[model samples]
Target: SIKEKPSSKAEKEDENPGTVRILLLGAAESGKTTLLSQIRMLYKQTFTESELIHRRAYVYNHIVSSMKAILAFASANDLQLSLDNQQRAKEILSIEECLGPFTQQEYDAIENLWKDPAVQEAYKKRGNFNLNDSAK
Candidate 1:
């Protein structure tokens, strides 16, 4: 007995023709993921509450890890910090403390810390570090 070839319908089903597929590609530091996230938010349904909670936790972890790396770089390089920024960094580096729901003052302090020349330089050097793509 001879076997018959699969039909086009079978091929399409294997490819999941009903599903939309998107590919993002760009340079190392480019915002491809950010653009994809924006597209998802604009075109797809909003995230469920549980998804939002999960994402919040992930964001917090990412921020904490990034801050720690910056601090380590600063320490290794003997980077100077203003008295106020030093205090702010201390608070941010406190892993035990819960983050988010920031008060206006805390928000301002964090923003200022990020804007500091040392922090800015460190941030620019982020390309030197390797972060898992999943974290982005």
Candidate 2:
């Protein structure tokens, strides 16, 4: 059996008056925008049926614009947050409110995806130390 959140839908919302921030650290082009948009669509809800659909669409656009980066946590990578997980979703948004926006690359790096060889190699190259002490 699945567990449920204690708060009602109206109890928590994007405009509830709190700040949230997410630190997305990634190399580059890791589909950060897509992930965020997907998250926004996932938690979206409205009491009425029409509101549900419209609100969901509205949520999608808002997320895309803001490009919510809270969904990139390594833990959340495997498990998606659906409408049933509204509580977590709200928390993420609330956090992002304070943290501000971050790019997909930001997410990947923050999530430690930079461990990849390519990223490591590139980083090494960028930060290479040409120690020519002996020649002196």
Best candidate (score: lDDT): 1
Please provide, for model 1 over 1-136, each residue's C-alpha lDDT reduced to its tens digit, 9 standing for 90 to 100: 9966668875656567576766788996477757876987898867778867776765666666666677667756677767889888887776654344555655666677777778777666666665434432
lDDT of 2 by residue, 31-127 (tens): 5645665766786822577645664664444443232333333223343344433343344344433233445644433334233333233333332
Name the runs in model 1 displaced over 4 angstroms.
1-46, 97-100, 130-136
lDDT of 1 at 94: 68
lDDT of each: 0.67, 0.41
lDDT of 2: 0.41
> How many clashes in each structure?
0, 19
Each candidate structure's TM-score, on Cα atoms with residue i matched to residue i, is 0.55, 0.20
